[model samples]
Target: MEQDTNQNKVSKADSIRVKLYWRMAVMLLVIIVGILAMLAVIVTQGWSVYKRQSAWALASQKQAVWGLVNDARFKLEEVSNMQTELQVNLDPVFGSYIGAGSDFDQLKDRFGKNKGQFNASLKEIETQIKALRGTNGDFAKLGAAVRRDFNQYDRDTNKLLNAGDSGEDAVPYEQIEQDMVRTKKSLSALKARLDQERKAMGEVKALTIEDMARTLSILVGVIVVVIAALILISMFMIQNFTANMIKPLHESVRHARALAAGDLTRKLNFQPNRIITENSEIGSLCLSLQSMSEHLNAMLRQVDGSTQRVNLTSKEIRTSSR
Candidate 1:
């Protein structure tokens, strides 16, 4: 019987006591948990953004290099086209030198004008290629090669034009043209290389964009998960606290009210087999209310009995006198 009694006894807990310690501790724990969680999120997101921004800066640099390469290619095309016009004017200049086709001064002036324009384009290529090399170490070797090729081409073409200026007799046209043929070959190679680099940069830019998009999606998902977890945890904890403390206190108030209204017969705990255990402040209050009700009921019963006896005594005296 003793073992059964012990087994059936309600458990004791000191949580939700009159002291403020337990509630304060819960509040502090919640605050610390929230702050720590937010800090972790901020650190993680900040690092990711920093890395992505670095990549974007690198891409912008690549774009600058690409633009330079492309501009060099355009200038090369212009120089090549102008060379054809120089070729067309070559015959008239030679005829003028022989005293036959056109005025010598007019022919020379036209050829010189075209040559000046061609040289302008060559200078632009030189500047743009140098810019490409200076922009980044990766482009340095290619830029040097293009510059070397263009220098050789420029020298050879100038030699040919100077030979023409000397006279038809001094011009070794075929030999100079042969040497000049290889002049443009270097530029063609550079153009091909620029094409390849442009394609590669495009691919890298696309990949970077995709990576940033993926990281953004992951961050959003992590934030949503953290928020949802916090909300659910808070709800569960609040419900437990209400049940253990708030509900019990509310029940104690109702019991006290009934006693004050002379309803001493009403039970503190109306459950058939359950009793409010005196394990915390709320339970202690219910116990005190029960005690108060019992004493008041006893006093009221004594007063009622006395009143009935006095009335019976008065009626007996009246009957005897009659």
Candidate 2:
């Protein structure tokens, strides 16, 4: 009984040691998992924010490009309107049929107020239009003619200004009309190219945003799966170790109580019980407990023998006295 009790105590102590290791392992696992989860969340959030910022930047770029295209188109339209007005002014110059006397004066006044803006638009339109026309067979002649017409118009305006005759428009009205028509065609072609570029840019921005969204979603999914897998693996490992450790402790407790109540047949039952032979701490403990159980068993045997001898000696004395 004493042997069993000593073995149970040692077994309980070993079980407690295993339990402590398992608990520490579980705590470490939890800490590691928590840190990993936090890192994943931080990474996901950072990626999400970066994606959103990229999308916003792309949108802003698209807006800026579209604005530029619109501004170019608006300037082209303004040039077209100016060409029309020039064509209207040419009528009186060609036919000598001046209808609205104040119209020419008013046109001159308007031109003076907007001359800088008009000249800048015309310069930009001329450059873009010439580039679109390219180096073709007949474009050279057309280009020469356009330059001559523009120069003549400038010279005539100067002459009229020097003469102080607001009524005398000196532009060759018929030739100017033809030049305006050609220029309008060129402007229209350039506008078409700008429109095409704007469309392409818009498509690129849309595709980029869509791709980013898909990638972000995939990243989020991967993160969630990884985190869940870690949690499950940690739980499984901890549970397996804890169960193995707790079992020995419960058995040792039951056996100890039985031995304390005088059951000598009680034994320390360890599951998957194998002899520990290593020189490690747990192995040493098991060896020590086995030795203690053997010593206790020998002591109990000696006590039993001593008690029997005493009983026999007392009976002999009583018999003699009788």
How close to the true structure is residue 7 of candidate 2, measured as C-alpha lDDT?
Answer: 42
Q: Best lDDT goes to which candidate?
A: 1
Task: Kindly list the per-residue Cα lDDT of model 2 for residues 146-166, writing each as its tens digit.
Answer: 445544544544443333345
Q: List the residue pairs that clash in candidate 1.
A: none
Tens digits of lDDT, candidate 1, 19-114: 345555775687678668767866786677666666566556556655655655565556666555555645535433132245544654654565
Q: For candidate 2, give the lDDT of residue 200.
A: 61
- Each prediction's TM-score versus the true structure: 0.57, 0.55
lDDT comparing candidate 1 with the true structure: 0.58
Once fitted onto the true fold, the runs of candidate 1 whose alpha carbons sit more than 4 angstroms away are 1-74, 81-138, 155-183, 263-322
